[model samples]
Target: MKITVQLFARARDLAGAEHVELDVPAPGRVADLKRSLASRFPQVSPLVPSLLVAVGTDYANDQTQLSPDVAVACFPPVSGG
Candidate 1:
């Protein structure tokens, strides 16, 4: 299955793009997708451990299943007052 992934804040900067398309196996989970992303974009691998993932706008866990039609977003920690 293919899914559209959005990179936010520092994640976008590290990846050098706002969005990317990923091709994953059916029944893939968030963790699996993360690994794939790291492999595809080695430059950003160092940040993967601190990244947060979301599916269709909701925060998701590593085990969370991915839906083909859902939009995924990778978010890095934010700082604010």
Candidate 2:
């Protein structure tokens, strides 16, 4: 399955793209997507440890299940005053 991921903040800059497509098997987990991202875009891999990943509208953990068509977005964890 192919998943379109929207990049934001630092992740977007590191990847040099606002969006990227990743190949994943159906019924994949958030961890799977992270691995694929690292493999395909090494520049963005460093953020994985602190990256925030969202599936649909909620922030998801490594084990969260995802469908191919779900809305996925990734960005470095945010901090505000």
Candidate 3:
């Protein structure tokens, strides 16, 4: 399955790109994709625990199931007042 992952804020800076295309296996969850990303980009691995994921426009849990057709985003916590 191929998914487009968008990175934001500090995650984007660390990853050195705003988005990336990932080829994940069938039946993979968000967490699995995260792990794969960390392996591929070791520089960003340390920040994984502080990251949040979104499926389409909604926040997603680490265990959330993913489909190839869905749009996903990975980012650090957003802050505002």
Model 2 over residues 1-81: C-alpha lDDT tens digits?
Answer: 889999999899999999999987777898999998988999999998898999888999999988876999988988778
Q: Model 1 clash tally?
A: 0
Measured with C-alpha atoms, the lDDT of residue 61 in candidate 2 is 96
**How would you encode candidate 1's per-residue C-alpha lDDT over 9-81 as one tens digit per residue?**
8778878999888777889999988988898889888999988998887899999999888889998776778
Q: Assess every candidate by TM-score.
A: 0.91, 0.92, 0.91
The order of the candidates by lDDT, greatest first, is: 2, 1, 3
Whole-model Cα lDDT of every candidate shown, in order: 0.88, 0.90, 0.87
> Per-residue lDDT tens digits of candidate 3, residues 41-71?
7888998998899998999998899998899
How much is 65 displaced in model 3, in angstroms? 0.7
Candidate 2 lDDT score at position 77: 84
Worst 10 residues of 1 by lDDT: 71-80
| Candidate 3 total steric clashes | 0
CA shift of 73, model 3, Å: 0.3
Candidate 1 residue 10 Cα shift, in angstroms, is: 1.8
